[model samples]
Target: MRTLKKVGFSLISIILFALLSYVVLDFLVPKSNSSSSENEEIAQQQSRVFLDLVAVGDSLTEGVGDSTQRGGYVPLVADMLRTNPNVKNVQTANYGHAGDTSSQLMNLLEENEEAQADLKEANIITLTVGGNDLIRNFRQVGLNGSVEDFETTIQEYEENLNSIFSLLNQYNDEASIYIYGLYNPYHYYFAEFEGLQAVFDLWNERTVEIAENTDNVTFVEIDSLFNPSDAPTETEVESNSGDSLEDIQDTNHPYLFEDDLFHPNDSGYKVMASALREAIEKELEDTDSLLSMNR
Candidate 1:
């Protein structure tokens, strides 16, 4: 009887010890995970930096064709910036005027105190100009015009762009400027007009060159997002799934334009916002990496 009692006691002791160990491990493991998560959150918060955005440009920047009417890419970008756990706050000022040319925008920048103040305080600036400039010429002469015809106009636009950059730098040299390149809305319509493509390509190339030459300037290329493959032939575009130009204007393919077949719809604006966001994130990453290396 004593031997049996001893055996029973040993078994009970082993079971109790095992249970106690499991209970202790369960409690400690969760605490360790919680502590690790808290540390990560704290580190992320510490790494976050505040952003101030200033948007200036033409009708596109003004959010003209967006059915949501939510201030186009401006609000979208602000929302994205807010999504970052690290971004403590995002302040935005938009001076996007409908039908404003580059010269007109420059005038506004020089004359408007509010815009100048915004630029001075901005950590990032976005521009969408030069489209109306070319569009006006196209409307006047149609595809019959040659690239050489716009030389003077292009030169003047370049000068205005330089002045715009100079003014922005003067207001805040540290602010990163993102300039959107022009996308040919009429590419499908004027596919046969080879000069049209040449002119648009030349304009984009010049815009890129200008951005590269300027400090803290990034040219956001949106042309490809609209024209995914090569410029579709007129027949191909016309026969695009049997949809009319008006029907396909907002159809998410071949035509990202609004009903007007010019301005971007809400979906199109989102794409623009995405591109801008990516560029901003990349710039921030590069800056962080440089700082870390220095440290």
Candidate 2:
């Protein structure tokens, strides 16, 4: 009987020891995993920076012509930024309405709470305005939209843009604002219109002036990119009886979307993205920061 009792006690003790050992190992393993996870997070934070990029303006920013449904150059730019070794992640917000003009964008800036919040958090801003403003004026007045007509329109546009810049500065003064210059989408269709090119030039010039005067504002020129080397002159358009304007456009403007010839296709957006990326890289170098200014 005494022998039996000893055996029972020994078995109970062995079971208890096993349970205790299991408990200790479970606690230690979790602690080890937690420490490793924490170390990894710290390392990631040290090695990479995150950026919030906000793109605001018209159809160009909205990605109207892109079949992929991604917001045009905005996503392309974000993708490029992601490839940078220093950039860990990029959060992008696109507030591009197809028919929105500068004034409309101002209204959106004033009214939209979510956009306001994103703007406040933005490390960089890409703006594509003035094009719709010009387009709207031309539509309202027809071919009568001359340089003189555009002067008044441009003054209003400048006022609205200044308000926009002021609002953007107020939202996040540290953000670098990159605004695109106007390209004459009408130059091909209205090849006979004498003052059309001059109007686009004036608009772009005023836009450059505005950007120059604003703090941390950079003007990105895209007008020249759309002008194809094979584009015909006024005489060619008038003489080319073999091909229609649509055919000529199809042949000449490969970067333009076939559906509406106004907005850019995928390749065009790529070029714009490339231009934007170059500007951002240059800014980063100038400021002596990483790919994006961590604000």
Candidate 3:
């Protein structure tokens, strides 16, 4: 009878301890969740200010895929930014061309009346123009009938790229210029261009080195964001709705292109948008922390 009494006491003690533990955890959990909410609040508080973004490049920057703010990455990024009270009223300027090479882009930059006006108000710029340069170089190589053609093309590319960066920096001394690394779109679909991925890497590495020497400049890479499955099988929306890429035009140009299949599809644009969104958030977070430290 005495042993039974001891057993009953032991059981009661165990039950009491468990109840205490459960009560303590219940109290702590809400506070733990609130910490995350607090962090988001801080981020929101910092985002009330909007930064102006100016983008220059080929078709990718032009919103050829899903139609930009109406559709593609830039608009999505801007929308996301606005959600964080820290970022409000973001505007983007698109300076993109369908068949623009680096030299052509340089000419366009020199002639842009809007860019001149933009110099006064632009705070951020993103660039993704060099891919066309690679295409033109490769085309010239094919026409010239020698591998040596690539070397000359690269030399020209180097000079033009340097000048473009300097020009962008010159126009916007206070702006943060984010340049995108070239994507190997050829390798993305065609089986023959496997080695070109290395070429693209080398090109991106060079751009990174160039950006490293400059201040308030960063190079974003979208190659990693893409997968074979992410590529869109559909054509880009045309200038006129009826003139789509579904009809075969020529060997150099196919119906799969609004201008060219070389440009990204709507799916590709979404991928670009996703990558840009991540970049913007990370960058803003870092900037907010820096501002706090300064305070």
Compose the digit string of candidate 3's lDDT tens values, residues 209-259. Answer: 888888777777876555344443224323334454444243222212345
Q: Write the per-residue lDDT of candidate 2 for residues 52-141, one digit (tens) a residue.
A: 899999999999889898889999989998887667789999999998989999999999999999998888899999887888778877
In model 2, where do residues sit more than 4 Å from their true spots? 1-48, 228-241, 246-252, 287-292
Comparing candidate 1 with candidate 2, which one achieves the higher TM-score? 1
Sort every candidate by TM-score, greatest first: 1, 2, 3
Model 1, residue pairs in steric clash: none
Best by TM-score: 1
Q: Estimate every model's Cα lDDT from 0 to 1.
A: 0.83, 0.84, 0.65
Query: Candidate 2 or 3, higher lDDT?
Result: 2
What overall lDDT, based on C-alpha atoms, would model 2 receive against the true structure?
A: 0.84
- Candidate 2: clashing pairs of residues: none
Candidate 1, residues 1-295: lDDT per residue as tens digits? 9999999999999999999999999887756778889998897767777788899999989988887887899999889978865567788988999999999999998999989998988788999999989988888777769999888778989999999999889888878899999987766565667788788889999999999999889999998887666656555856767877566554434445535767887878988999999888787677563233222
Q: What TM value does model 3 have? A: 0.67
Candidate 2: 10-residue stretch with minimal lDDT: 283-292
